[model samples]
Target: MTHLPPSEFTLAVRHETATLTVMIGGELDYGTSGDLLNEVSQQLTAGQPPPADVRLDFRELTYIDSSGLTALLMIHRRTSALGATLHLDNRPARLERMLHLTDVLDHLTAPPTRAGGWQPEEDDGLTEAGMT
Candidate 1:
């Protein structure tokens, strides 16, 4: 049997006044998804007024399993409870299809966001890219 690399996931958090952006990289599986959970929990608990928007950028996410999906769902629930919205950005085509097939896309994705000439400064909040 071929051996695969040990599961590793990284979450890069950028907290802003109105938005908290998390960029996830590497594999999001059972072994690594908890890091995401804890990070989100800490951020949510620490933000005094709570962020109005929670953006998850999966551009570098190589793979994600059911447990990863569940973790994302948890984030969704927490965001909703705080009266905030969640946005899934830069999703790969296959991953997007899988979310659609699993009927969980609506729970994680926000409406499409617009792109403009401006770029994000270091602390400009969660910058989103187009889904298509």
Candidate 2:
């Protein structure tokens, strides 16, 4: 059996006002997914107040697997619980396709719901049956 070289991954962080951007490069697979998660967790919980926005800059990212997708979901949950918005920025075609295939693109990018649970959408006195 041929052994494959371990994937090389890198993360760079930047802070701007209430936003924290993590620039990801290289492959994000089973072996490196945890690193990304841990770094984001540390950043999220390291201060008096958490960032209002967390952006995962994927412009430099080259590859990702299921583990990486799972990490994204976990990060989303963390940010949402902290009342922060999560942004998956500059996603490449493959990443976008994976998100769409898994049907999680909406969940990962939607604004966190207000406290007290789900809110009803505004009704302009219109019904699906077409009776206003």
Candidate 3:
């Protein structure tokens, strides 16, 4: 049986005036998906005002699975509930393919609607190539 190396994941957060950017590195598979969710949760409730935008920087992300996608959706929901927009930045090619194939790339990166709902924009003015 082929063996995979121990899953290595890390999150480095940068908080700005109205945005919280989390730079993620390494695999975000089942073994480490929860780390992303927990980190977001903790940051969201750390007595500071909730950010108007939550950005997940995937510049160094190496891999992801279904669980990771689920985590992204969950984070989207959480941010939307607080009237915040979710941004998936610097997505790698594989991750972009996965998000598109899973039909959640737009959902995870949508802006909040007037009714406080989440819906993909027709022209969000963002492209995978420009994300980086």
Candidate 4:
């Protein structure tokens, strides 16, 4: 069997007053997902206010496995708990599909919308119906 070379993972960060963008490249698999988490954790724990938005730029990311997806979920959870937004940016088509297929795209990019996102102040005429 032919063996493929291990994937290379690289990370870069750009920090602004209210935004932190992390650029990721290469593969994110079981072997490298932890490193991603660690890098994000370090920045979050740096004592300064957590950035209002923590964005992951996947413009150069080539691949990601389930473990990598889990890492993203973890970061999303932490950022939410800290009142920060988590954004997945510049996702390649495949990556976007991966996240969508795994049902994590919305979790990472936007807050979940409630089943009934809005309700009218007035109720429907159900009570007026004889069934009431």
Candidate 5:
């Protein structure tokens, strides 16, 4: 686990079978998204043959604004360009709702789950969360 300066986020990187798993915590707002981006960039650049998978664990993320969403999208695009897969895991309910509402959930590779281990089938459509 390594901590980066100038951000509240912490990154725990683990290598397994050509995959790089990054567990991220804290707010991924505009203020801290750059740090995360930099961390990913550094790891990819330093890898011997490029990573096969970049798994992002979002179980501890407390908040994610528009900028944060954009960052994630950017990272996904970059990883795809590098011929790597990006997987998101354990997204918070609020964030999940936001992603669905934004019509971006289909682009995510992670399975959706509710607070109580309820896994909704894909194509269930978006749920309203009182956010507009």
Candidate 6:
């Protein structure tokens, strides 16, 4: 099935110590993944000792496709190769389900809790639609 190009999305960057956080919004499908990939590449190549950690905030994202998942995997591989950790933060329910069903959640990182609370258990790899 063909998916439409993303109509809207935004990217922002912030730093906390050696960690660089990239906040993403809107659809992350074929048409919009490049923007994310480019942003990551720029940060990695900017000569800043390779960020100790890279966090992707997807709280506002509304959609993601297989291509989008591929883009995220690419980011993971790139960061792993550079010896940096990649953290996924505040994922919306739909996207979280997709990641779990694909059995890739174990490969991704979650945001640290502010109050030093217990870590939530990893997702069971199930989506609300019951597709796995």
Which candidate should be chosen as best, given TM-score against the real structure? 2
Candidate 1 wrongly placed segments (more than 4 Å): 1-7, 110-132
Kindly list the per-residue Cα lDDT of model 4 for residues 1-132, writing each as its tens digit. Answer: 998886579999999888888999988877777778778767766656667789999998888877788788877766676667888989988788888798877768775332222122224332112121
- Model 2 lDDT, residue 82, Cα: 74
Pairwise TM-score winner, candidates 1 and 5: 1
* lDDT tens readout by residue for model 3, 1-132: 998885478999999998999999999877677778778867766645678888999999989888788778777876786688899999999999998888988788788653334323223343212221
Q: RMSD in Å for candidate 5, one decimal?
A: 12.3
Query: What lDDT, from 0 to 1, does candidate 4 have?
Result: 0.73
lDDT of 6 by residue, 1-132 (tens): 998865578889887788889999998877777678768767865765777789999988988888778778766766766667788899999888999999998786633222222112224242212211
**Can you give the TM-score per candidate against the true fold?**
0.76, 0.80, 0.80, 0.77, 0.73, 0.75
Task: At residue 96, give the lDDT of candidate 3.
Answer: 93
Q: Candidate 6 lDDT (Cα, whole model)? A: 0.72
Give every collision pair in model 4: none
Per-residue accuracy of model 2 over 1-132 as CA lDDT, tens digit each: 998765568999998889989999989877777788778878877764788899999998889998889888877877787778899999999899999999999999988764222112324242212210
lDDT of each: 0.72, 0.79, 0.77, 0.73, 0.68, 0.72
* Candidate 1: C-alpha lDDT: 0.72
In terms of lDDT, the best-performing candidate is 2
For residues 21-129, could you state the per-residue lDDT of candidate 5 as single tens digits? 8888988777777667667767766756777788999888887888777767766655665667778889898789889889876675533222221122222132211
RMSD of each: 10.9, 11.7, 9.2, 13.6, 12.3, 10.7
Deviation in angstroms for 95 in model 4?
A: 1.4
Reference-based TM-score, model 5: 0.73
Model 5 segments more than 4 A misplaced = 1-7, 110-132
Collision pairs in model 3: none
